[model samples]
Each structure stands twice: as structure tokens, then as C-alpha cells.
Target: MLLVVEDDQAFAGILKNLSHEMGFQVLLAGTAEEALSLARDLTPSAIILDVGLPDQSGLSVLDRLKRNVHTRHIPIHVVSAGDHAQTALSLGAVGYMLKPVRREQVAEVLAKLEARLEQRMHRVLIVEDDERQRDAVSKLLASDDTETVTAGTAAECLELLRTQTFDCMVLDLSLPDTSGYALLETLSQQDAYSFPPVIVYTGRELSADDELRLRRYSKSIIIKGAKSPERLLDEVTLFLHQVVAELPEQQQNMIRQARNRDALLEGRRILVVEDDVRNVYALTNILEPRGALVEIARNGKEALERLATSQLHRELAVDLVLMDVMMPVMDGLTATRAIRENPAWAKLPIIALTAKAMPDDQQRCIEAGASDYMAKPLDVEKLLSLVRVWMPK
Candidate 1:
């Protein structure tokens, strides 16, 4: 099934006709809202998105789809009038096409989607220094349709990658011959080797710097622990686009439990400090459904007062804060530093939100004591993912 999101009636008709010629059942969405609803309800095999939508940008729609566990594995191709190809691809769209597209271009995109849907086998590379650990992961992820390849060092991993392409790679940061960090850097510098979506599954305790570095090279990072195996299965299956229902009952249960942990926001209190009522409303809509108690603060000064009062009245304790950077009375950066200075709020997670997504802006937010940073206009799914990752576990 192919879901087409386009407000332009003529263009949508053209897309529908082309898709039918390829023997794909077509579902059309005239607005972003409709697209999101159909996607969440039907879980289409692939999506063809347009940038111009009545309610929201197509890029945000793409962001939300990729963040959602059920919809993340589905391939998406963007057809836009704007030059947002880079952004769309970064958000996980498989391919991007500009407006005034040729028939061959659309056909090519559909062909690629067909190939992905028809491919029966998925190859995975497990790169771990310990032979026992490598073998164990291979066994755990083993399936009738999956081919698992193992490497005990960075050199061997690189050698395998140079010759053959893989669907995904499960990497460990600790390698005997070279560190995982070095290997990733090597891959980034060289263009000959195939670099697949890497899941960094390791036992190494990582510092903030280490994590930030790894985020550049890896798709998901799982620290070895009691529930690590289940989480690994969940991530691997997602990247492989495997059919969960077809898997063994035991693996299915593991995937279910791993996904259930995403409900970390349930019953948690989040303080949303923003001057804009529109943003406040949007955040509320996203968080409240997840069972999070949403509290609003007009500005940075109001946020500080609320925190102070919450501390004085233990019953009002907030689990996390979504601080908007640009605000009257007091900016979020100032508020974040003040909160960090307070001994009582030392462990509280503060995520800084800003309209500017520039590198320097991110650096400033980090320097001001923000636990993390996100750019506006907010991507609903990414915001939820960040909240889950930063919220107290």
C-alpha cells in the first residue's frame, strides 16, 4: 500500500494513476492531519509526501512518522516544491523528488520501494571484540530470513563492509585493534565502504561527550543490561523492516515489552515554559495524551517561581522541563543556569527549545546548562522521543 499526501488535486491524481500502473493500492491524504491519522491507523507499506500541506509542513510529518515505533520502519519518499531534500532525508525519508517531476523519476522511486518490499533476506553485521558476545547476539537475532555476519575487530569489520553491503550493523564501541569511535571516523572519511544504519550495542559506560560523538555515527545506542537484549531485538527488527507478527512468539513478546517502556511520560509532571500560547497548546496536546501532567509558565521568571514553589511544596515536584529559549522577562538560557545552581533541582532534566537550529545556537544552549536542545517548529514525534530519553527512568 502507498499513502500519498498532496493537497494539489491534479498532482495527487497523477500520483494515484502512476501508482496504480505499478500495481500498488493508493491511499490519498489532502492534509497533514489526514495523512498522520491514516498512517497511524493503517500503517501503510510506504509514503509519498508533499511539502505543501494545509495544516503542517511535510517535513514535520516525516519526523513524526520516523519517530513512531509502529510507523518508523515504513519507507517514505518526499515530493516537494521547496528545497528541503536534505531535511527530509535527514528525517528518514528514503528518497526526495522536487516538483515538476518526470514520469521516470516517480517510477524510479516506486521501483525502489517495490524492491525493498519484495526483498526476502536482510543482512546484519555484528561487530564485537569478544567472540562469545558476538555469537550470542547472532543467535538472539537469528531468524529464517536474516543473515548474521560477525567480526571480532574493527579491521575485520571494515574488510567485510568493503566487499558486501548490509541492511544494518550492530556495533560495539570497544574493539581490540581499534576503538569503535576510530572505526566510525574512518568510515565517515572513506567513501568506498558501505556504511549501514549502525546500532551501537555495548557494555561500556559512556560519558556525555562519548554519547554525543556516537550519536553522529549510530542510529541507536543500547547499553548492555538486563533488558538490553529485548531492546536490541526491537531496534534490529525496526531497521530490518521485519514482520513482527511472523516472528516467534518469544521475540514478539520481547518487542512488545521493549516498546511498552516508551510510556515513561505516564503520570509524570512536565513544566512547559513558553510565552506563546500556541506552542503551549501544541505541547499540551502532545504530552497530555501520554498521561503527563502539563504545567504552564509564561516566561523564564515564572518558571523559576514555579520551581521554587514546587520545591517548597513537595507535592508539586516536576519531573522535567521544556524551556523555550526566547522569552520576555527572562530568557530560557538564564533560567536554565539558575535552575542548575540550585542544589535541589540539580538532577532535573531541562530541554531547551529554540527557533534557531544553528550549531552555535545549540552550543550556547548547552553552555547555559540545558540537558538537551530541540529546534522549532517542533517535530511532535522527536519531541516525544527526547522526552522519553531525558525523563527520569
Candidate 2:
């Protein structure tokens, strides 16, 4: 559900219609008073607030929401006819969309808002000592519609968990009352299921044993200060979404079918041809971890050499090749075409790996007879997921 708070009746109606068309239940309010009342009643998934309101300024309403104990966690996107975007952001708006807004722009913002809400609604608790940090984290999670409760200390967090259920926790390792690690130990001992998935956000150094200990409790540990808050949120959002959600039976069957498809040969011998060491390392890291027997060919000549040798051996039939678009001796496009023209490897899966993410580049790669295309710097999780879907178990 979404709350659209715009004073312009026509605009509010348009927003409501668009939101409903986008498959969201939208509640509209033309004045700040109505908006506040509706917000209090609905506890909406996201709020699109106009800076201009009839009863009160939109900024004032936003301030009220943030200051209120009950409404502080609602994600608000400020929309304005005036150029106060910076001010709106500083005042705690998750996003600022200027008027007269395009339907596409609104849709995009709503999409992100929905994704964030889905992430938050699942269940997450934020534990931090600083009020500002707690609010910031809460706001971040709120944007995703993730149900988040903030605790100023470890003791408070434990108390909350005792009474309520949470799927995950974002804990500051340094707490005013008790150590985060000690809290983890305490939670672990309470009951097996009492310990929720935890993400450690701290500046303190964590040893391998500490990581292992957290993992034992089904927690993910991340070093703070190394990444921006946005990046941290992204990682947390992705991790929680993946770890907490179980695949539906239908989706699971689809995945199994994709895994068993004849076109996707199981445990197929793959040759990863790339020049960049980082790309090679990352690909190897993701694929090897997933049980793919990955062999590296640093350049096109080396790749061809491997193919030629494989043809002679008959035992080394390369079922798939991940060719980097750019490399020495012959680029991936040329190499892919060469391999495609050959009868033995014509039907083989040849996916292109390229730094180019533009649509034109993808089209070019397709024209070169590439079976599939993935962009670089590779998303390891996405890569692995795609591989599992395309390749047999």
C-alpha cells in the first residue's frame, strides 16, 4: 500500500491511478491533516508527500512523522513544485522527485520504494547506541518496508527479541551497555531459534574465529567504515532477501527443470577466457565455490590452443566457454565466431563476459554468435544464480 499526499487534487488523482495501475493499493490525501490521519491509520508501505499541503507545509508533516515515535520509520519521498530537493533530503526524505513528475519517474521511484519495503517487511531489528545512527538505520530499512525496531544497546535489543520475532538484525558491534559479541553469545544460549540472522556493523577487527562463531548463529558479519551506508544497506538488503526467503514450490520446480535441460549439460567443462587477473579471480571464486570445474585461458590464443588440444584428446570436450569480449591474440567476438563456425563446438554454450553494459554492446555480442551475455564487474551471486539456472546440477 502507498500513501500519496498531494494538495493538487488532479495530480493526487493521477498519482493514485498510476499507483493502482502499477499494482499498489494507494490511499490519497489532499491536505496534511488528512495525510497524517491516514498515515497513522494505515501504516503505509511508502509515502509520496508533496512539499506543499493545504493545512500545513509538507516539510512540517515530514518533520512530524520523523519526530513521532510511531511514524519515524515510514519511508517518505518528497515531491515538490519548488526547488527544495536538497532541503527535503536533509530533512530526511528518502528521495526527491520534482514536479510535474513523469509517470515513468514516479513508477521508478515506487519500484525502488516497493523493493525496499519488501526487504523491511520481512523482519529486521537495528541495534545501535547513537540515536542518530539508530534513526538513520531505521529510516534506511523503512524505505524498504522492512519492519525495523531500534535498540540503543545490547540489553534493549535482547529484551525486544524475547518478546518479538525478527528474521535478521543489524547490530553495532560497539554498544554502550554490553559488547556485541557477548550479546551474540547470550542470544545463542537462550534458545536455538532465539538467535536471528545478525549483521555486525562495526569498526572493530573481526578474526576468522569470530566470523565462524557468528556463522554458527546464522549471522553475517560486515566491517563498518570500509563501505558507505548506501552500499552497506544494499548488501544487507540483498543478503536478507536471499537468506530469509524460501523459494516457492513452483519456482523450485522451474529451477530444477532449468538445471536438467539438455541444452545445459551438467557439470560441463567450462573454459574461462579473460585477460584481467581480477576478473579471472572473481569468476574462479564464484564458479569454483559452486563446484564448477573452471579452467582459465588468459588470452584468445591460449583459448584456441586449449580448444585445439581438447579436439585432439576427445576426452577434453569443452561444453561451454566464458569468453571475455576484449583480450589479446583475438577478441572474444572473433573467438566466439571461430568456435561457432566449427562443427564440433557449434552447439556449445558460449557466454560473453564484457565490461560493456550498454544495449548496443549486448546486441553486438549476440550478432557474434554468443549464446549469452553477462556484464562486468561481475555480480558473483547473480552469476552463480544464472549458472545454476542455465547449467545442469
Question: Which candidate number would show the highest lDDT if scored against the true structure?
Answer: 1
Q: Candidate 1's residue-wise lDDT over 103-222, tens digit each?
A: 899999999999999989999999998888889899989898999999999999999999999988898887899888899998887998998877778775556577678767534443
lDDT of each: 0.83, 0.70
Q: Which residue pairs clash in candidate 1?
A: none
For model 2, the local distance difference test gives: 0.70
lDDT of 2 by residue, 337-364 (tens): 8887888877676778888787688778
* Backbone clashes, each candidate: 0, 8
Candidate 2: 10-residue stretch with minimal lDDT: 258-267
389: Cα error in model 1, Å: 12
Model 2, C-alpha of 379: deviation from truth (Å): 1.0
Q: What shift in Å separates residue 370 of candidate 2 from its native position after superposition?
A: 0.6
Would you give me the overall lDDT of model 1? 0.83
My TM-score estimates for the predictions, one after another, are: 0.64, 0.35
